[model samples]
Target: MKIEIGKDFPKFFKPLYQEEFELFSHFETTAGIPTVLFAITTWKENGKPNVCFHSWSCFHGDKTAFFAVMGNLYQHTHTYTNIQREKCFCINFLPISYYDKLIDTIHQNDLETDEFEVGNFTLSQANVIHAPIIQEAFINMECTLKEVQDLSGAGITAMIIGKVEHISVDEKYAQGYERYGKDGFMMLIPAPQNILTGEPNQSAIASVNIEKYD
Candidate 1:
C-alpha cells in the first residue's frame, strides 16, 4: 500500500511553529525538500548592507548565459525590495561553520541595520554589481536581476531569476573535488512530517559529503 497526498493542505498536518503552515505550504514538510543554503547580500535603500539567509534555489546556464533561479523569496523582505531598487544582488556560499552567524543576521535585520556587522562579517563590494559580498564566503556570485514572478499569484512570495554576471571562488576551493565534505557547502533540510502520524519535525542544517563520483 502507498500513502497519497493531494494538492490541498493535509488536515492531519501539524505545524512546528506558529504560522508555519501560513508561511509555508504543508507540502513543504510533506516532501521535505533539501536545497543549498546561501546568503543573498544587497544594499538597502538606507545605504545599509543587508544579508538574507536563503535557500530553495537552483543555478543553471546555457551556452549564452547562466542564471540563479531563487524561489520562495518573501516579497516583504528588504532583500526583495533592495533587489528591485538596486537591480542586483550577491549570493555568498559559506560552510556550516558560518550557519549561526548567518542566522544572527536574520534576527538582527532592520531597515537601518548593517547586516554584515550583525553577523560579524566583513563586507566587500561585488566586482560587477553594486551589492555587498561576504568576505568570509567560499564563493560569491554577483548577479543582475533578470525577472520576478509571483508563481502562486498570492502576492506573498516570488520566484526571482538573476543573471549570473561574475563569480569569485576562494583559492583553496577553486580545485574541483575540494568543493565537498565539511568545508564545501551548507544545505537546508526542510522539516519532515511523519506521514503516518502527521507529526512535525525540526529543520536541520547539513553539509555535503561526496559518497561517490560517477
Candidate 2:
C-alpha cells in the first residue's frame, strides 16, 4: 500500500535548532529503540521513587541510557526527583501493543501507589540497576545515569542522557540460547505496496531482531 502523502508533519523539516542538530542522528541508532517507560517508586525526599513513566526515545543505539530529559528541569515532577536521587533507572522498551496500559500509567494515577501493581504488570528487580522493569516488556534497556547536562536554552527539556551497562530480553526474542532475535521476535514493517497489499498489514514489534540486518 502506498502511504499517500497527506499533510506532512509541518515541523519535521523546519529551521534547524541547536538542540535538533545535536540529536539529529538518533534515528540511525543500531539498537532496538524502545520508547522507554521510566517507572519511579523510591519516594525519597530527594530520591523519592515516584511511579511516573513516559515515552522517551532511545539514544546512541545503546540499550542502557538515561531518561529523555532534553530541556530544563521542572519545578515539581516525580520523575525528576527519582532521577536526581536514584541516579540509576531501568529503560523498558515497551511494545506498541501496551500503548493503552502505558498511557494510563503516564496519566496521573494514585499519588502513593504504583501503576505496575495497579496495572497488573509483573514487577521484577533490575538486573544491574535499582529500578523496576516491567516483566512484560520484550526488551529491557538497563541504564545507569552517567551525566545530567543542563541544556537550558530557549525552551527545551534538560537532557538526562546516560550510558548503558547491561540488557535482557525475553526468551522468545532470543536466538538459539544466548543470542537475541529469535523466531518469535516482533517486527514493525513499514507500509509498502511491494510487501503488504489487501491483507492486513500486521507486523510484530518485538520481532525486530538487530542481528538480522547485520
Candidate 3:
C-alpha cells in the first residue's frame, strides 16, 4: 500500500531544528530533495566581497536566452540586497573539496566581512559583469538580475531570476565529460526526516558519481 501525505502538516514529520522549520517548510525535510551547490558572489553595499554558499536553484534557456532561477534566497541576506542594488551577480561552481571553505564564508559573513578572504579564495572580476568571481571555480556564470518574486508571498524567501550573460569555463575542465566526476561539482543533500518515527537526519555535502551514459 502507498502512504499518503496530505496538505496539512504531517504529525509524524518532525524537524531537526525548530528554526529550520520556521525558515523552511516542513516539506523540505519531508521531500529531502538534492540540488546543485554553488557560490553566489556579489558586492556588499559596504564594498566588501560577499559570497553566499547556496543551492535550491536551476539553470536553463533556449536559443533566445538563458536564465538562472535561484530559489529560497532569504530576503534579509546581503546577497539578496546586493543583487537588488547592483543589478548583477556571479555564480561560481566549485568542487566538493572547497565545501569546508565555503562553509567558513557562511559563518564569517557580515556586512563588512570580505567573504573571499574568509574562504581563502582568489577573487577576480567577471569578464562581463561588475561582480566578483572565484578564480578556483571550474565554471563561472555572470548574470544580470532579471526578476524577483516572493513566491510564497510570506515576505521571507524569494525566487530571483537572472539572465545569463556570459560563462567562463576553466580550460582544464573544458573537455567534455571532465566536469562530471569527483572533482567536478558539489551537491547538497537536504536533511531527511524519518517518516515513521519523525526523527531528523543530518544534511550532507556530496559529489556526483556517474554510473551510466544515456
CA displacement after TM-score superposition, residue 46 of candidate 2 (Å): 10
Q: Candidate 2: what lDDT? A: 0.50
- Per-residue lDDT tens digits of candidate 3, residues 1-214? 7556666778777778777778777788888899999999999998899999999999999999999999999999999999999999999999998999999999999897999999999999999999999999999999999999999999999999999999999999999677877898899989977777888899988888888989
What tens-digit string does per-residue lDDT give for candidate 2 at 1-214? 5533233322233323344324433221222244333343334343323455443444575344434332233425666667677786666655445556655766645557566766567877878878777788766766677767655453334466656667788776566432333333223332221211222222124434454452
* TM-score list, all predictions: 0.98, 0.55, 0.97
Summarize candidate 1's per-residue lDDT along 133-179 as a digit string, tens digits. Answer: 99999999999999999999999999999999999999999877777
Rank by lDDT (best first):
1, 3, 2
All models: lDDT? Answer: 0.94, 0.50, 0.92
Flag the better candidate by lDDT, 2 or 3. 3
Top model number, TM-score: 1
Better of 1 and 2 by TM-score: 1
Against the true structure, candidate 3 reaches a TM-score of 0.97
